[model samples]
Target: MSYGDEHRYGESARADDELFGGSGQTRTRLPDRAGDPYGGARRGGRSSSRSLVTVVGVVVLLIAAIAFANRGGDGSSSADDRGGEPAGAATAATGKRPVTTKTGGIPSGFTHDAQGAQSAAANYAVALGSTNMFKKDTRHSLLDLLYTPAAATRLRGPMDQAYSAEFLGKVGLDSNGDPPTGSTFVSRVVPVGTTVQQYGDSTAKVAVWYMGLIGMSGERSTDPVTSTWKTWTFTLQWTGGDWKIAADSQQDGPAPVPGDDRAATSDEISKAIDEYGGFTYAR
Candidate 1:
């Protein structure tokens, strides 16, 4: 459940020292195992035992070689190790200030670059899939903040019509898009990872893979609780020192085969959703 003491950046001073033999000498050893029955055998038996030892030694060496190769060269750093900066300045910015500014209670102010595009994509997926979008006022505000100026006005009316009173009722919400008195509404989005497909000085294309929760909870509920995998792709532009989405689209994807886990009771799902708060994501 825990990711251990390793930092998110993948840079551990202890790991580095261990890999390079910080004490100025590398340890060496011969391959041998105790309690071998062939230790004191006949001449032919001794030869066979030597062969076995040789095989074991080779296996050990191969494993060590593979480990070293996988770790990359000692001079290289991983993507996470380079910190969330534009690709060129990434390594030098490793210990730079964290990006944690908020706009209208939503996290924003990402640097204008690949890392910034990734962070924006992840957060935008959450906002777009949120339950608040079902309400008229909140939906408009969220769209205006997230989309480019041209797209915002164009999408607003269509989105409002899509989440109309009739649509809300079909989804188990009242005319006002609220759950019944004894029931609970649950909609949440969780980001899995981000990828930048294209990058430039002023624009970037990023995709976020995410799982979302939608549906209502009650004895008479339909569409009880389900998980969906969606890829949200964003075209982002640098404007006023921050990365902002220009256009975005969603597509179903890369979903795993469903598990056989038993479905939770409606009430349980409702209670859990109500009790838990969502996260503010960053890449």
Candidate 2:
């Protein structure tokens, strides 16, 4: 994405097209918003699903806000003032500055440190698990962008086979990665947090905890939108001054017990996803 192009975050209809490429055939309809952001409509009814997202956002912000009550985005406080947390223990939000430039709308040029590894892991998780992974063109573009050249060459064929037409049909999408007409296919990855398992001058192993949404939204759709929890561990290599994936794996998550919240209607789920953009996921 160029500086002149519209900026976006998260993999939704417009964002993916602008950042990666065509992800699907459907378009979003945002009917309400008091301020009319992109002509968006007012938010819909309350549901456990909606409340969960809101709560998570509040929690993350609250933690960052209270992480160092005496400190701020500007790092005025030192380790001596931080109760001397173990030298390498993951500290609360450090108010660390994020990279200012972007590559394909993806934050890039991470620092050479543990904090940089964590940030790269979180952002990469979101990009990899995005809807763009389904389409061939965008998938290739993304693989080129997110993976080390050698990794991209190694995974191309396997990834293409994995998202074969038959697999897409089972997931209610066409060979072209489009949902049935009148329906919207939803695929998004929302990162919860990141942790560094190992870090070195040339490489890092990092894990990302995330919640993913995948399904088709339509009045008569059989596969309604749903969510899943997983942790993705990525092996990142420092190449060309960027952290690119060398290898990655995923596993079932430490998912929280489900709350007694009613699932949102398809329209509600669809609208909510369209209205709420994803974050750049920085410290």
Candidate 3:
């Protein structure tokens, strides 16, 4: 199985038309948050200790009020220090800094909130779809930084199996995961937008809509580099002061109609990838 097949886990196969060319978009509804519905009743008791209990309750309430006030109305001030504004549309940037640190070349230290989750998901999409993911060392580093501990362990084996020697040959990569001397392999993911489908204090479901470029670039290349649009949904957990991927899935097209612009040549594409660098994506 290909990495696309294995990594997508239980998702059904998408059609070529849906994957490569399509109009409009499809939004997946996230699972609703379940609530605890059975709180046991407290037993009634009358004793001289009642007065002391009431005094402690008042002190606790005062402390909570001070904490809320310190947060400036909503409890998320720490994450959205600039104040969270409505995004208006599904694809708007939140106009806030998403992360401030890097670990093993992947972005780290995401704020503990929804915008932070969106940011982490977008950056991870770029990393996962990049040519670097074909190499074992860099791939392992990325996996460890971006995914939750359990998910990283579970996926490492299957993902290694999926990106096999045969698959490398098919994609024009050498056994060591390098492109031919005269050729350039492209596998960059550009995130166009992000949406928080569901959010909580400690978890978030975010989707990144992105365009990915893949294939080989050279005069003798049979599989010329091509682009595909996809929406990648990630389930994130607040762990170790950052958002980590708990799970993820992908679906095809919310793609727009192709433009009438002329296609660039193989040399031009290769030159561009080499000259241009990717951005630190934020939402």
Using TM-score, give the best candidate's number.
3
Quick one: best lDDT, which candidate?
3
- lDDT per residue for candidate 2 within 50-142, as digits (tens), equals 967987997798688656543443221122222222122333466666677789878899887666777887888887777787799998988
RMSD per prediction, one decimal? Answer: 13.1, 17.1, 17.6
Q: Is candidate 2 or 3 superior in TM-score?
A: 3
Model 3: per-residue Cα lDDT at residue 91: 36
* CA lDDT of every candidate: 0.63, 0.67, 0.71
User: What tens-digit string does per-residue lDDT give for candidate 1 at 1-283?
Assistant: 0010111111111232222210111123464565665577556888989989998997899899767644532111223222232131111222333267888767788876566677777787787777777788887888778777766776676666666787788788877778888777777778876665556678666667778777778888875767777666667778777777666656666687998999899978988987888877665
- Which should have the higher TM-score, number 1 or number 2? 1
Query: Stretches of candidate 1 above 4 Å error?
Result: 1-98
Candidate 1 positional error at 40, Å: 18
Give lDDT: candidate 3, residue 153: 85
- Give lDDT for model 3: 0.71
